[model samples]
Target chain A: MSKNQTVEQRYLPEIQRKEIDELKTTVKGASQKIIADNIARMKKADSHRPDTMKYFDDIANLFGRRQQEIEAEKQKGKKIIGYLCLFAPTELISAADAIPVRVNSGWYDTSKLGDRVVPVEVCPVIRSTIGAKMIELSPFLEQSDALISVLTCDGMTKLSEILSDQKTIWGMNVPRVKDSTQSLRFWSAEIKHMKTQIETFTGNKITRNSLKEAITTSHRATKAFRRLQELRKGNPVIMGQDAMLVNQAYSWDDKKRWTEKTEALCNELEKRVQQKDWVCSPDTPRVMLTGTPMFWPDSWKLPALVEEGNPKGIIVADEQCSGERILNDPIGVDEWSMDDMLNAISERYLMASTCPCFTSKDGNEDRINWLLNKVKEWNIQGVIYYVLRGCMLYAMEYNRVKKALDKINVPVYYLDTEYTREDVGQLKTRVEAFMELLNARIDF
Target chain B: MSTAKEFWRWHEYRHTMPNIAPVSDDIITAGVDVGSVGSKAAVMVNGQAYSWGITRTGSNSPESAKKALDLALKDTALSTRDLRYIVGTGYGRVNVPMANKAITEIACHARGANYIWGSSVRTVLDVGGQDIKAIKIDATGRVVSFLMNDKCAAGTGRGMEVFADLLQVPIEEIGAMSLKVEAEPEPVSCTCVAFAKTEAIGLLRKGWSKEKVLAAYTRAMAVRMANLINRVGLEPALVITGGQSKNVGIVSRIETLLGVKCLPTPNWRDGGLDPMVAGAFGAALLAKALYEKTQQI
Candidate 1:
């Protein structure tokens, strides 16, 4: 424990402690393994899952205790602010003397009760989030003093409306138009409002020096994350979805500490690459994944992508929303007054972020170009465009993305998925077919 | 186990039986489809289906595949070694240890359906035990685009199997019985097979006749399949393949919904080929292609 952290704050909230003791629900399903298969051609890790990382089971099983841990952080005089989208920069919240914890629910069964309060057709993540918080099933509601939501889509905007009655929420106006001067200015204004909210809630003046320090801390994490990303290009040294976990942990863990751990992991990964230690054979089909934010137990795509059912192993590259999204852009904070700092943060998130919701024709075309470049650069022969069930914006952009990838004769598989095991068989068939095409083209 | 109690178990619908014989010619290339519902093996020689066998898939996919292949080669007096090339497909395609190559059932279905229905068939809708696929094919029977339902079982063959068992109707009789109803009750409105089962029981308890209940479930399956088919954009030449293609109840309802009958023949050839064999037939064709390519090299 950190010197400033107290024992009381770290203890599990009474209700969760009792539930965890009785059920062990969070601890028991602690391991999710993605078999790299017994194919003779690959050198990748035999399995990638909770056991792949150090303290993986401990971290994965730590879900039920999260609220108390964050609460404990709060007792150490840190303000806990929950965020929903990548569009809302955690750096800004950190600059304001608050810890930004992304509030995504991982318990698939627990999210079922969430649907009583939401429409059945709403996105599973949204329904689950609403259910978890409304039912007091999630530690997020218990730990968070405030919420920062980027109004990226209807589900999130409405989620903010529903959640605002429970706690303070500052909705960031995520503009649809990317790279526009007006949109950038508008987003910057929203960040300014967010600054005021943080000030009022925390009762601490965020000085220029403190904000600049936060930016520096954030940049360190980005550098480490970027390093991991570089290690993942083409033939990945890191097997399976372990790289995804490193990125996912960034969403919840303290960025500086997560950076150190990731950096350390990168060093280990660097050695593996040098030693020619790989999880999959060089012949494994390389796939570029996009669509849907997969976090924690919200994991379906990663396992399906690289699992044994596809015969020869498949290597998954870090994708738009989950992998490179958080680490790719850093706020350039030279002389960090509130205005300059907020503008930098806004620029990093709204302008630089390549989310499809920020769709201007030129912006979308650039995203396609970026995807095409990623395909060739990463040796990705196939693309899996996975859309979360009821995710409209991402699903809508499929045709545009597909056309560009198609131009290069790259095989693309579009999957509309939910967090359920029932359809895994179907998904496997589609992916296997895609793999067949990709593998056949390998010789060509 | 009786199909009723086993309705909840997807593999219980597993069937492994074959009404098969041999062509007694050079048809030796093999295609195996080890699916969640069933396993099939087709042996092709001289560009014609020689002998094929169907069997219920067991827990071990490779074993089921081998069993089907053994049965397929029985009349021909051959073994896996005798076949020039073998292509495995369906959900268990990867599990076929003896296959030279594993193809996606989507591609296999497209290739197989093209041969059965003919080249003009542009759209292929295949509802397997646990999946529903709408595949758009080019003139050459290559998959141009495809869409699949990856949620709960509603429009799939699994749902029909459950309804068949729930009503205590033999799986074969349910289709005919569904049409025998005097009037169609409102089709069960749920998109989940489990929920539709509950709805089936509720309707049965409400004194709805067995035929009527079957009719309701069948109609619901049609509506669901139509929605999926519409999403992929149905072309003029549409055909239904896979296990569910045999269900006259769902097929008739789908025809009514589209107001056009599904192809009576596989294609313009006016030759009748069993729909279930389409995936295996396609695999055989691909195996043949690969074998010829290898020989040329």
Candidate 2:
């Protein structure tokens, strides 16, 4: 491959190409450098300050615009209803032409907000979510045509009641199914009920034929995304972080434009893969990002983990609201028949559906095992578990996860952050040391 | 010899000279606090606080306590032999071997608050370096119901420290800077300190004045603190203590939010009298009562 040849000229896996394209077009006019700089400044400032206040206004404005856009789209004859939980009938709702937004309370400060609705001692996430509601930060409360909340944790269970009091809210009692058969039954009922509720909310009857068609389209999109992940795994440099950003944007933004951009980017990446041409840097070490994404300014530590530590630093996977957990393992479709396809999608979704907020003593173990398997398969050197300061659920389970990971001899770096950049100096030292340990192990 | 050298030599001689110790047991008692940020010890001998000392809580708190205790004993010219009993409090209370018993800071704080500001106080808000707690007290300064901020450092002194580091100012300066604002800036929305940074930057880009933003952040935290205060139910004459008590902005904001005036005692500078020492003082008082009862018997 010649130096003049563009990344698009190289042959790349179709899925990898699409993900890269998606990342490129996610944020309009905002360069990665600018975002990185802003995040750096946020990390450097004291956790409480005028600087943090400014950041909040900026994020709130962005959310405000997005909410209005969604509302306008609904007014233009688009059927859209927002769902709260990750498993609140996403495929079914989307099939009915509704948009499901994951309700994350991690975005706002809870001090005042928690006071209005919850006790100070409750989980910080709950307090913050209530805080968001108290301050009217969540556009969903006012703009959402309808809201769906699943009982996953004590926090969510309580949230259901709070949300149901609002107009156009639906509460689904998601049964905890331990057995495979029971799981399938529960999911099937959920999908059917969700489809009906969505249809009722929109006042448009969804035909079986239309439902099947929508399911197929969603299935294709998910497959393409997963295939991209596989390609990136096979040849790491072919799809970089920017590509991943674009892919997430594709999922979160205007579907039509995102689809067009993603298709183009995928074609470009495929060309790069064909020529076996990519940016090759010294491989430092590989690690998986576990736990939640630092919500304040998004964890500034990721770049520090990669750049300062000089590690291969593949964010192999995450159990966070912001990463692979948000878009991994799409609904599967069997080619045999449409019924088989629907069943396959539902089954896959059920098996793969896990949230960090899920409450069970064993939930942490399940998450650890899942990530450990991925690390082994991907040949990752270590695991970095970055948790937010006030997240009680994750904080309680950290020692358990650390003990489990220790059994596998995978060094884990447990970083507790308030999601502020001021702690960057401390964070950098920790990440550097963690990387050094990984390197030392390899050398030994 | 030069006058400065002669003065230093005289000081050294004075340090070596032994003083005549007071020949009284005086029911001397001491309290030790093993806090995350630091440790403190207070000695009350014969119904009077004779000496108090503070030091950093190093890796081993017992050693820190021994050092703090030694310093207090030296100041009062007393010895461990003269002390009747010792009480321990704070996170590392269990680690204090010499303590006769460990008391929860909640109980100790209520007692201390009552001692400083008569028994009429109904609510006590103690904001420490690493945690924040709210306690409801009865007419006698006993804890009725209490609420704690949990393990997160947000909305505590640690949160203020993070802000101080970001703004390139001392933590003490934050409260003063906050007071200069005419209007409150937008509130940071994220619960995690990490995400709040991003929210902070977004605010910066929108051209918000620094003082306004700082004021808003203080108000937001005050709101969080107020939540805890409301949980135990607000009462007249609320008292705020702890290392964060120095932040007038936070104290004022909290007072406004709760619609109450917060009172600080004369001993506010002594790290709110080391809750552990307060506990020890209460125990000594109890011992005095017990002694009186045995005399009657």
Candidate 3:
């Protein structure tokens, strides 16, 4: 096989090649439609949406203008590094002078194509990621020189192996036991190894100075994100779905630009707060959404329904990895030394994570505490805990989180769903019922 | 040549008390619940259920809502315009053009169950046309926690109707017929209605009687409902509501499975309100509260 040959050209015959060509068109069209429809819904999501939101919304339009921007960046001789899980440190990818793009997709049509490679019961995130890669439809996946595959779950681990057939893969072994000295040391070594692999792949040595700059870049974004969280506390000026879109854009946007735009959005929200221009009435139910990460297109459903009631309930905050958790949990770097920075990054990514991948002695006390704090801070009346079907780790942790919320008298509605739109009606009823419960409680 | 004509059809009816004359100043409220398989409307006067009607939901939801409300208002001096407030519920709640407010059937059922059986009811299991819900409510009929069946049509009124049609038994007779079996048979598949139907066909091939097949299905539905009920947990004075509560086979089996008898559904002041009208009745009760709140404001 030639180095420059495509997967289809090498593996498929002429007839199958033509079939794939037609299928690729369908996949591309459907993916764009999903992105466009979601963006339109998001723009009209609130009547008082800040003008700064358009920037983040455009970046979330996966196959749109963002692709041209990525192509231009590639033309400038910068390597694009695609990643899936948050465990893959984005700062390290930036340190190697490579642009990091989170390539996890939430489109249903592309996930169907993945059935050919993986079983149907595998996680939709894994399926869509691999499915987009197989058809070469995702511009981010196509442009990425290498994918940083973090071993977070069995599905992701297997996904890396399947992706390795067509792409350059750098696999990271995340320690499942998050709260121990031994695991910390093990993770630090793994990060160091990843640093070396990324440096070699980009042919750029990650000096201590470049690594510090990268850490500072993410820290600036985190600063802006923390400010946004502060604004969301008292009265929700921004809806959860819009805030999640901002966080999601951080995965694909240029770090400095994302920080600037987020800071601007936060500024608008601050103004709205002073003007008392709340997105929803004060009596509306303040819901805190947690559980599995919701990516673009598919992320719109639950959050949209959350706010689409007579009084229109508001998602005051969310603890999802794709929402508030992005650019959060910043690294606490004491020394500017390479080893210390690497150790801090490893610790921040591993120990501070509430992602259900790690098993702590207290059974997700960290996640529960994080959720409870959010609930209290926002005065959230309810919690909508939705798990994407086949994402078992989040589903498994629901009962524990529900039990914790029960102690605080906050109601949690557990919804199990996939990427399809088939169950929207059913989900709407449940979500509305939950909103009704919260509203009635507020009336008393 | 099977000549049995639509064994699953259930008659629709409207009833109102002739003794209580219509008072113009009284607070009038209506609740229209347009479910997937059936539609119901309950009219309440000053928080009391005055009249109610049940009908099969047609293709057009707004029409169904109108038809149900018209039936409930039939032979009554009060017209639809006289109602102070109307609350719509169930799956087609949003489509009710005349409703001033639309509340979910979950909240409505808990409220209706409280009104029907009193505030002692803590857990309410409502088996409706397309789904089942196990709701845990407080003394004030406020929903504390509730669980609805997933996006499946098993263990619901619709599933029971399918069984009735398959067995060539009238829908109303299914409960009594299922009880006629001398010994309890093994339940059918408790997973899916489609799979259970296939299993029932297999049982019939094995020469099992229709009564035994009906028993097996009802038992399976009861087991599924019991699982959901246990998941929500059984508090004291559990009340069963909705269309499936009319079927004693499922209700009795669920009682035996949970080892707790459900509270009886008495004829609401001899108005002959069927258990199927719980959602509508509950909505009517809520409408009365809303009307009163507005009046005070």
Candidate 4:
């Protein structure tokens, strides 16, 4: 061992560390290119995109202007708390006077670096997130003072353990059964524990007023998100990818600014609806995407393929954790007391979530019910169930979702994929075939 | 046929009917299917199959599409301008230069099977060059649901070709020769084609007969196909299409595994169409319907 080496430093050699640093430089350029290409495609997708979408494009640019803003925040001695899953209560982070950033990495190249630490069979999201930390690639992940790791699924739990060695890690155990009253009490206690952890990490006392104000910030964003969802229902003036970008920016951009920008986008869409300017024809097959969450550049491929051809399909809505469901359900509080507010936050993040991670008494009936209601509300003609490879929860739940959709005569196409670009040709053929079946129904 | 040293080659050919019927007021449409390994062009006169040509796909898809169409219309009076509409199908469908619209091969195969075997055919198992698709359809030939083999290339025409090259047997003759084995051997037992190829090489080194090796390979292919067919929830009467359908070794094995006889695809010598051209044929049929719809408007 070297003279200054510790136990942790010995496991990872200096030579391997130097190699990873070199790889990090190349991955940064490739990741920026992926973001730029996707943003270019989004802008040129349809002529009806609102001008306010530029705000989302800028924030989602990865190492662009938002990265600079984050660096500036770091310079001002503000702590950045990175959260892995949606179960990490951002309200507490903001209340503790720290910036909350969701650090789920979607870049495919970064996953290769993560392969050194984790096995190849793990899901790409976990690998990419770990790899991003290993190389210090993502600005959001690099700037974080601590990471809030929610043990939502099996892959995520292991991911937290691997990441804890690099950063000060705080853990949250999500109860599996959402319908039980006992689970809520357990989760409320966990949330209280988390508040104290964040307070100690950031060295800021989270008062009742601070929590109240943070909840208000999220409520404004949720109200704008609901408005955007309502605008997508009757007529699709905004493309699905654009709407997803606005939501994805919630994880990066300042929440209050995201709220104002989304509201402005909704106002622009309202005017388009009045003028009868639609992105696609009235009869194009409206499809809903469900299953595992897809973030940023990785999510753009499917939406682009869906909206590609003449008389193309439009992604009218999605039930993914990364999409419309990101913040659509606002937390309701009867009183502003600390205990009542924590109880409300716990219930909202845990109980109301239809994530596949939670298995109630019945098998996936909650998620199925949510999907069916959204399908009817959006006039969805087809459903695309996307499962990222190695994500066992979503992959295993495909049949239950399919069986439920089958009962209503709404066809579901099961798409199993990874974060790689090699499968684009295969995915295109399957998606086009599904579109053909939907079109045949319309014509015949 | 192979010489003492050189490998036997799969020949490429094209044919059209010697006689043509007098021109009528029927609308003519065509389809071009540019696949990963093969390209086919089919011409339909008044929603009836007129002629088709199949050729090996080259490095350039648009050129291959043109060559296939040229062969289909070799001695015919109909030209590209004569057809009211042209639709493209298969993996390289969008690369067809003259295609008016691109339809997916899944839809095309179901519709083509319906036309080839009549409306009674409700399930189709199309084993293509690089993919295997099991499609379930309604009585009217519209696709109800379908499943295709992912990323892996086992149980496809390409997989069969690998065996043919390894055994030094002609691709067509491998099927009949494989059926002559005393009894079916256990399948290659590898779900991946690369691993199966290695296993086949290992079996050959152990002095297994060529016919027995062929039997084992085809059986493995059949099992892989059957798994996909079961997943798609097969309905009868079933029909098989694509180049692999001509392989009796794979076909009989699949029939036995599924316990259902696939309806016959009439031989070309018997004045019937080639099974490989099914995707193009279906696209042609859909092109006619699309043309009629436009005319109505």
Candidate 5:
């Protein structure tokens, strides 16, 4: 906060240091301080519940070690495909003998570079993605033989068009509406076309056996995450951010390794749950994060919120994506045929479409039902509808979420947010006040 | 909880205008709003406005809350104990010491604007230091819908301060001085405060007059705020409140842009209520309602 220190150094809020800087917007003093603080807090938090830390400590490598892993795979004669959206189906890319590295935009200086090419008004996620490519800051973007963009929202659609000029951008047209009976067949056809594109681009034949193995590996990771979600139901053994990191690990690292580490974490979490050892104060208020995709290492809001805020007894759970959306559903393929497996994948993804991207009459009802069930299941006290500043899809649905939560007599706090640390003070104040409101609402 | 206010006051800015001399102890309620840029406190006696104070918030929001109350209580025969209930609102609401309840500034601003501007006022635009809020309200002064620009200061008072410092014009003179420009210049077109500051310097370096630069910045503020206002679908009988209402440059440009005249905001100098204390005033009103509800129980 001194005169000489940069604005980021002065403004960056209290974040633990040991964890990866997910947003990767590095501040000098706060970054170092957070590193030290994160180590101490994670230790202190994990001390009482030894079962939780066992897997978390080991799996920490999944964050910063992405580029190195991609490089190692490239040296192993494997092609890498950097994908933007979850709908891209990494399993298919891997089936074609290409390593699917999930690429996200969060590097700080990339935005300045991006401003020259794209209007500054576009979403920061897209800005940073294009910026990363322009500056060659993203290892995944650099390493990938091709990039896949899932037409999830307006931003991704525009991003795909712009990025196609530089890279082999495959724009996968996933239908926006989810309710039509033919949409499954529609999406299944799209995925089948995507497989052909990958096979053609990588010049690798995607055999039926390879596809099955990839689905099984993906199922294991999500199944482990499902177990982790079950652990979140009672006594909250795993802090929400740590659980989110578990979900994020699926996209960044080797799938088999991610599943193994997550399963190990889940095993510890199971023990802690049985022992009734809770890291958070029993008074902790459970809050479900319902909003847009909060990309890893590029999105630090979750970690920042949970580090100090969770300690204040506010536990964040059930993120819209990169948290629950990635982990909630499984790809079905009991018969193991190519067509059958593709159908199952489409069906599971349809079931996992909790995002408002597939807006329909049932959108609010379906989402509200899921939220209501989760609130009751996890004993949630409130819901935090966190949105990226320009992410209108999630921001647009706040009223429906609030209306539903209101009926259930639960409070919902709508947070329009961004990646910068400048407004950390303001966010903290609002969150603390919300905590006070939730506490006061509790019936004694 | 902490008595750190004793020494910190020397470094902080504090002010109170048109102080009230408390005569009755009947149903006295207080509200403190510790905002990012400034803090305000209002004391209401017998469901009526009494006195209020404004101060620049330091790190200790609790002290800012207490100091705000202290200044409001100054020149009046009143103390903290005299207030029956204390309600805290705004960004640092939870940090306020001795607050019976905490509420959001959006709700408070709507209710306060309704009370000041009249029950017929359906829209409330609150431009605070670091953020801007546009609220739609019903006849009961209950919030129908609200849009708040999160974590950006480009169109708010904080942005105004940046332009003020760059042009060597006092914050108070930004509005009037901007209007004096012979011909209006195109507004700076960046939403980022930091980016817009650079854009502003570029204009000045091009030999644009200080008035011209101020004119551009003011139009930009109005343009930025107009988008936020259009979000909730502006209703007639619109009113502006909070610290930014004092800036005529932004307000008049906004009026021109909206093509609808703004409902006159409160001005203490004109013997009207201070519009800046809307959040705190509304908090006090809510405290009275809560106090009454408890009394019935």
Candidate 6:
């Protein structure tokens, strides 16, 4: 088998392996329904698809197995509530003993629903968001006890108000505090307010001790994760593409298992880092990520192209929402002042949770400049901006950013991804060309 | 009556006393714009701002328009008979019977914005009493694209008026009140103007200070106005013309958001030059060119 094929085989889960084996035989004779049914069954059995009905059944099974533990907790009489944010500090919320859910809208048919509220000329993100609201397609919308809406974008603000009126809405006004001292104070107050809101919503008071405990646990996990990523940077022990997938799944899967597996992975990664056993492909070109990640499962191909071409060179320095914003934030509960701790957390969340839809041009420019600075620091050869198709805000602003980066002499490539699976090959070709261009520049 | 005639006779005597120059016909083309909030008339006699008239659009827009036109004509001592073409522009432009042609307020405002300021302006943001427009312009004062926020009164002069009434202060004093505020008040978060008024009332009942409330209102207005500016990318020398230009509070907040200073016209008062009239002036200039071309054809 080819190197890429071997890597793919090595990474495939047991269920995916079974499906591949079945697909080889099914392609010769099975009807479309049979094939689909088989795929669906496998997906149902998989614990990774947390939102699937089968995943819920698995949770029920776990509940059944842990009935004594659950009953004892129930007897303790703690109120259970779900909180949603663009990127909520899961560690903080978990510390508060409240379930924190990341609210992301699905990519369904939005043309009809979007037309009802948003103007036709507005960007597609706004349209899709409006469409999601009109059709109520958000997985967490119905289940969420309270929603925390950050002022990340104009569209998000509008959607938050609309959703909040339907349910309990907590407005998180994370300010753009630039000074480190001021930022810490601001983040601390925000966290305190969040704690209060959590208490109000769940009617379960979060004591100082619990908050600190939660913060410590989350801080440890984040530090470990960061260390693992840093290790990858030194030696191509882990493919950058695999790192991205693991990060994406980090928030979506069962936290206990994810943490355990990640710890194991980190241990393995530490050994590799010590041995200096990093993958190296001469053809691979290092590229930094910019812009929003389109909701395609195989959009991972953009980073995969770099790995498949050259194993160790590609590193993602920035991401629109997923990469840094979701992964980098840690609760600042160790500080003496709870307010200061909250402020620090809030500021990081504010700076990190920047969506393209926000009205601050300077903020957006600053983010781009920071990313470029990191690229230079890491010796990255090129930058790739993955723009979502129909996202108007980014589409409109892309040229402006390009002009700004051009002055700095950084080569930038833009790829538009439709969150559909069919565009994988087209995405692969574009990414390949982008990687090649970066490599050519390095030679010169 | 005797004193009035004596004064006129003295003015005539003084005019005759000097080595006076001969009178010229000086055929001038003029444009009149009667808008929802104000009326303005401009006379370009021999390609110059010979004279202009402006007044608040009151109960009778057409009469105010006629008064503005008459004032411009009187300043030059020229009658309607001396004009080759008369054009009207604005929301109330259709009501001006003396106008040979009428144009929309948008085209007129863009022309006016470009005329008063040199045309390096890629975008024009005008906040009138009833409407607000973000216009993109070419080097020659022609509109490339434009966006307006007229569906609601939250970002317009009317919203300010409502807040002024709620505060029991004159609408003109809002700018000064906002300046005195050391701390910004809680933000008015409601989208609807009417709902915001209720929210403001609740705040008052809660004993929040008035200046703080006004400051909050200013911030909210700034946020709404900045949305338009953000839609059109920021270019330097941004000229903010209209009644809202007078509001120091709104202007300061806008500058803070855009990180650019707003340039107001020298004659920001007197409704400045009506954009509708400016557009009509442009149209007349175009017509003159067309007429000259047709004569050649």
Best by TM-score: 4
lDDT of 5 by residue, B123-203 (tens): 889999888888778776776666677666878887777777766677777789999988888888885779988998998
Q: List ranges where model 4 is wrong by over 4 Å.
A: A1-17, A362-364, B1-8, B17-24
Tens digit of lDDT per residue, candidate 3, span B160-261? 888888888899899988989999998886647788888888999999999999999999889989999898878978988988888889889988999998
lDDT of 4 by residue, A114-229 (tens): 78777888998988887777788888888888998889999889888887767878889998888778988899999999999999888999999999999999999999999998
5 or 6, greater by lDDT:
5
Angstrom error at residue A324, model 4 = 1.8
Q: Pick the candidate with the highest DockQ.
A: 3
Q: Answer with 1 or 5, whichever has the higher lDDT.
A: 5
Residue-by-residue lDDT tens digits, candidate 5, A159-192 = 8877775677888878767777777778888888
Angstrom error of the Cα, residue B194, model 1: value is: 6.5
State the lDDT of candidate 6 residue by residue for B210-257, as single tens digits: 787878878888888888778755666676766677678888888988
lDDT per residue as tens, model 2, A11-41 = 1112344643453244212323444454444
Could you arrange the candidates by TM-score from highest to lowest? Answer: 4, 3, 1, 5, 2, 6
Which residue runs of candidate 2 sit more than 4 Å off their true CA positions?
A1-68, A110-112, A139-141, A234-244, A247-251, A256-260, A266-280, A293-314, A335-345, A356-369, A389-404, A419-425, A442-444, B1-297
TM-score attained by model 4 = 0.97
lDDT of 2: 0.58
Give the better candidate number (3 or 6) by lDDT. 3
What are the per-model numbers of colliding residue pairs?
14, 60, 0, 0, 8, 12
Candidate scoring better on DockQ of 5 and 6: 5
lDDT of candidate 6 over A1-444, digit per residue (tens) = 566442222211223446434543443232223223433543432223323223222322211322343344445764333333454556566666765555444332443356556556544455554454444444334445666776554555665665553556777765554435665466557667777778776776666676666666666667756766566544355555445545654444445555566677777666656766554543356667778653313244455444543112466455556555556656544474655555555665655554555445334455565566666665566777767665666666677767766777776666666534455533443454345345435641
DockQ of each: 0.41, 0.02, 0.78, 0.75, 0.14, 0.01
Model 4 chain A: lowest-lDDT 10 consecutive positions:
A6-15
Q: In angstroms, give how far residue A435 of model 2 lies from its true place.
A: 2.6
Per-residue CA lDDT of model 2 for B6-63, tens digit only, reads 2101000001113334457466667776666656666665545556665666789789
Evaluating just chain A, the predictions reach TM-scores of 0.86, 0.72, 0.95, 0.96, 0.86, 0.68
